[model samples]
Target: MRYSIEEMQDAYDEINRKERPLVAFGGALGGALPAAALYFLFAQIGGIFLPMLLMPAAVIGIFARYTGFPYRLKPRIPIGILAMVFHFAGCWLLQLNPFVYLLGPVCAGVAISVSKVKLSRVQEFAIGRAEIGKLGPNKSIQPTAKASAD
Candidate 1:
């Protein structure tokens, strides 16, 4: 199962080209939808809690799905940042609690961080065109025992 560097690069480029747009659009939608939902939820409920911390992470998860579990961090960074920025912008628009607004960056940071970890785990086990496609641009790759041994 030896892959030449060129082959690896080809796979990376192929995956990136296919994934970048999907991840960007999906991440944007993910961020915007939740922000709007949370805004309305807060407007109706009028309370905030730690569970909100999950929003950005969820946004990142959506973004990661489109990322196709690339082997590098460079691709994941932008999607995470975009999710945060969109989340913050939506919060600002909805006039959410100042505390929630303040938490936007922090939440985004946590989401992005978690995405990195997931990406690493996925890349370790993702091999071959079939596996990569199955992993898809928007799915997370889980590390199998074979990956751990490597």
Candidate 2:
């Protein structure tokens, strides 16, 4: 069956809205750590501009790992681009020492991934809020009871 233009457009929009904001944040943060560390150390020996050199590699590596690797083998999806962006902000915007920058993301990822590490009740609530909703606005139009029973 053919879909009308409106149907297709609506479908396209729904998919776009559901995308999580965490991917870029995470990668940028991850990359920032290494970049900053290298930059700082190199700044001492090579100069200010030199140590910051590794930033590109960090960004690219994080992007490749989070965005590319998982998808290549199978399917690819991100929780939220927000996390990715946050991670980047922590590293670059915050100017965390490289070592310090690594701590937040590593710990944060582990806590979110393993489910063993404890988080505050409030913290858990915040994360839970981030979890995706199902059969909701971002999804395709589904038949209701009336539509289905007809």
**Best candidate, TM-score:** 1
- Tell me model 2's lDDT, rounded to 2 decimals: 0.40
Q: Say what the RMSD of model 2 is.
A: 12.9
Ten contiguous residues with the weakest lDDT in model 1 = 117-126
User: What's the lDDT for residue 138 in model 2?
Assistant: 51
Question: Model 2 — TM-score against the truth?
Answer: 0.28
| Tens digit of per-residue lDDT, candidate 2, span 1-150 | 454434544543443343333453355445555545654554356334422433434443455355322211112223223233444553575455576444444433432332122333443333333344422335445544555655
- For candidate 1, report its TM-score: 0.51
Give the candidate number with the greatest lDDT: 1
lDDT for each candidate structure: 0.55, 0.40
**How much is 124 displaced in model 2, in angstroms?**
35
Q: Write the per-residue lDDT of candidate 1 for residues 103-130, one digit (tens) a residue.
A: 6666666655655423322233444443
TM-scores, all candidates, are 0.51, 0.28
